[model samples]
Target: MSSVGDLGKVKRVETDVVKCKSCGGTMVFDPATQSLKCEHCGNTEVLSRDTNVLERDILEGFEKAARFDRGEQASFKCSNCGAVVMLGADESAAVCPFCSTPIIVKEEYFGGLKPQVILPFKFSADAASDFAKRWAKRRLFAPRKFKKTLSPENMHGVYEPAFTFDSKTRSTYRGRVGDRHTRVVGSGKNRHTETYIVYRNVSGTFDKFFDDVLVANNSNFDQKKLSSLLPFALNEQCVYEKKFLSGYMSEVYQKDVKDGWTDAKKIIDANLYSAIKSTLHCDVVDYLDISTEHSDVKYKYILLPVYFSNYRYNKKDYNLMINGSNGKTSGKTPISPWRVLFAVLIGVALLALFIYLYSFAE
Candidate 1:
């Protein structure tokens, strides 16, 4: 239970900075060692985690807005691609990892809610790049140059912005479902089978609890393509620490919490519809209209690890996403014109051979 008084006390909390003891250089979170590593001295510092992941009441969070001052991290907005990038506080300059365009720091942009839990990158940069190369090798239509010239430079380890929602919903639905049936009528030439659907009015109450429904908050990237890299091990999350963001770049959430919840409900409704349909146990559905009442809804703004990169082919850019937790890769590449032509030729040859075999059999 929370009151308005609790809203006043709720504010953005900052994580402590992790510095290298051996050298004066700042330590960054390294996925390979699961510790903070210094770029200048190669010193590794271990981080302790004990915080349990908690889901905040979505309705209550709207009452108190939290904002954190930029202490040890710098925020940059890409002018060309409109990406909000966060970098180390000591470093003042950086290029946009998505478009390779120069980014300038913006002071007015308020960083969104601090992540409570983060699934750290499980794959190193070299390993992620290797996964991308292997994935591309299976894509027969991918251009030869794209695979041959593919190097690790295009891959970047990024902390992508996302929100996870939990909710208990009670939906009262009313809809019509149909089952297909066939009937034979008349005789001889008039004897024909007619297919018709038998419709029935149905109403039911559905109660469901959705634990985690992940939604993307970044708009700069292709969301559908990003979703292809799913099944991230959310159970392996740790308390969000600034050290975890040491070497990687993080994106500021462009979507607001309110909007994020709205999107979440859409996903919930779709899942609920499927659940209802499954309960009905019908082969076909003509139409279904459902009205839902959601309660005990909670959400958490978190950052997930991803190895994002892009490549250019024929003056067009194709984006790639690698799941940082499991090394799953998904991306778009330019299709080779020669490969399509060769496939067409092979199909024609096969058709000709089939026609000759049929004629000989006849």
Candidate 2:
């Protein structure tokens, strides 16, 4: 790691490269051992784990946030797809995992907020691939040929960027809700049953505290993709250190802090709406309007471990993601048309048989 001299005299250039003491070879972070392992000599070095992860005040914003100096860190820009990837200190060149374009390392600074905390990968790449394969086999509609031919070599580990927000919210809501009531009307042969809703106005105040509401800060890795790999163990996050990024590529967050907070508020509002609706205890909701105020807002810029891979079948590409922290897998798969048609035919046959039996009984 590069050391900082006098701030007034020299600019700080940080570089983190772990080397094995015995063989003098580059050592990368090993997920299996949660330590630095020399690739050439198989020597392992323990990493000092820091549990003091702190959250930053949203009001302070990015102006006071620390940034990396571009002159020393290695980065590469893909000309084909316009992806900027940051490499580990020991790497000089790599293939673009997004587009398969060859990238030569360049020493240019990519400015973005440094991560405050990171959920380091808990499993190795081979384990992630196995999890993906198991998930694919469980997809009943997936094509057999596609499943058989799925390749794990395409998988790549990436430290996807995201922002986790914490806030206390107070909401005042007004809504009309209804309960269904069934009644028998008329007499004799003209008697019939009618269903009606009893609607009433409702207003209430709700207070709640949200912790670690995660919002993806990279455009390429959107919220939908992130949500599919749900339930990350955010409590396991450690203080951010460049050593954790060894042997993996990290993405720079394109979305800024303010924008990230805006996204987080949306998620919070959605949860608040659900909670408020549940409290009403109505059979139906005509309409609901809620006004909320967020207070004591805090945010942490964090990096999540994820494995990205894609499979192409019949000229269509299906993307796959595996949670590196856990073995959970999520992805798109091509459906077998024949299997779908067979299922639909069986469903129709069952429905027809049920109707025939009912008519016969009548």
Candidate 3:
């Protein structure tokens, strides 16, 4: 079935939010204040955390499920690099932004449920900028221009959507088990020979509850790279409140629960396999295949917070991420060509000096 998000004219419409009526001006989420504050209007709008709870569970056949995009997003396809791009509100999208490919947001169909929870901007533009600067400083190999020019103006706090899941699993399996031991064959030679015997049958029931089995809503960012900057203060996360999105740049879910749930299940199943293996706790095994079934599954749609920025240096794109909830940071950085060349030259010169000194000693 088509979702409500997919039916709209794909072009995302930026809505004009009203200021806190008490104070007449733009109201936005303030990280330091941890509340919505109006700068021009001086309206103090407070956010309340709902007492409602979210469910986390493993959905059946998560990997095999439909992978589709559904929400208000402009899909950018880069013919130069075969990269598809998406932009958010805080993003000062100039081009491919990362690859410098000229980008234009065009509306399109998105087939996903709206997020139920959101962790608002606890980290602001200034915070993100400072974080980026410190991050560049730590990167010893990063190009000077890339770090200096890649200002916070290039940074944006984007609310990326994701699904977290939990599950109970029962797995049945039959495989060969191997135990390693060495036996002395000849007393005179003292030679040792290794032997193996396979154990036939294995079956077990395993259960584990997963919290925040996350599947990303954004496709532009690599999942592994994104996960490196994790633990998005999900516990403090509240139900999706638009008031949080005010004055910030963020993207709605392009990937829905149905599709995201599929990704979530793969994560759960891997955990399930680990749980089952942990339950077994055996030394060695061969030809292992296990099938699992899931039950009592529940899911929550959440908009997790993230700060994203990408820089292009020496014709390669470097993406950086910051955890929006806490100040934790993670991502890949580009090394400067000059730095590498200079190091190599110094090493070569040292080697030449060492050879000359060795010749004199000889």
Candidate 4:
């Protein structure tokens, strides 16, 4: 609830360095043990898996949400891809995880709402790379060399930004729906079955409470790709802590709270339409107009784990995104034109043979 000017006076950046009690070495959050492990010595420290996540009221967030530009931490922006990333305090130089461009420690001011909760990475970078490799192998059209040339060492762990909203909605809808019916239309040889639609006017009131409608806050991470990596185990999210961000780069959110809520509403409206249609139990829908009122709206700004790898084949570049919490992967891969041509030829040959056999039978 602090204003940007009020909080900007404190210029101390929050550091992610958690020193080991046994050894003086730096410790990082290790997914293998779900704890902080010392890099020098093999000492592990358990972190409290706090599940008491808070959702701020939409009105309150608009007025008094904490802004990151208050100077609590510094971020680095990539000149090549325009990605803003936050790094550990001790780190001075890092490569842009998205584009593999070398970036220096540039203390740039980032203005946005600080994350309220974080879903730490559940797997290591090596595991994410393995997931990407398996996913690429399943691409039927992908070139063979592209699959074999995938480098796991290029994988980078990043905490992607997102917004999840909860809302109670009441909707009044009016529409006309139709159901199909088959009937005998004629007599003898002319008698044939014809399909007709029975239309009826329907109107109803629907009341529903939607929880955890997530919208991606980064422009580079599109909604389609984010949806493909669904079921992020949001129940396991922990309260935002600097320690959770250790050993990983967190992307600054590109979309604001207002824009994020707008996107969330679109998702909610689609869902509402489907629910209403299902309740009507109609085969086809002619028209439906729904007027919805959203109340008691709440939202949470959170971060999710993702691994990205950019690979170049020939003169073009292909990218892969792996879900750090789960093993789900989505990305583009180079396709083999020769393989596609061979499949087309086989299809044509099969069709010609089938026609020749039918003519011979006649």
**TM-score of each candidate?**
0.82, 0.80, 0.73, 0.80
The all-Cα superposition gives candidate 2 an RMSD in Å to the true structure of 7.7
RMSD of each: 8.8, 7.7, 8.3, 7.1
Candidate 2: stretches off by over 4 Å:
1-17, 62-108, 149-152, 337-362
| Top TM-score prediction, candidate number | 1
On residues 1-362, what C-alpha lDDT tens digit does candidate 4 reach at each position?
A: 11132333334332224677998666678988889888779898898888889899988767644444433344455555666555442232344566544433332344446678999898898888788889987888888887775565778777888899999999999999999999989898899999999999999999999999999977767788789889787877888775776667666666667778899999999999999999999999999999999999999888888888887888998888888888889889888998889889999999999999999999
lDDT of 1: 0.73
Give the per-residue lDDT of model 1 (tens digit) for 1-362.
01122223233222233457998655667777788787669988778864598889987666545543455444444444655555553222234566544332332444546667788888688888888889899999998988864566767777777888998899998888988889998899999999888889889899999987888877654357457888788988878765677656666565667878888898899899999999987768878899988888888877788887777899999887889999888878899999999999999999999999999999
Error of 2 at 115 (Å): 0.4
Indicate the TM-score of model 3: 0.73
Rank the models by lDDT, top first.
2, 4, 1, 3
Which 10 successive residues of model 1 have the least lDDT summed? 1-10
Which should have the higher TM-score, number 2 or number 3? 2
Cα deviation at 236, candidate 2, in Å, is 1.3
Question: Could you give candidate 2's per-residue lDDT for residues 213-246 as a string of tens digits?
Answer: 9999776679998999988988789998777777
Better of 3 and 4 by TM-score: 4
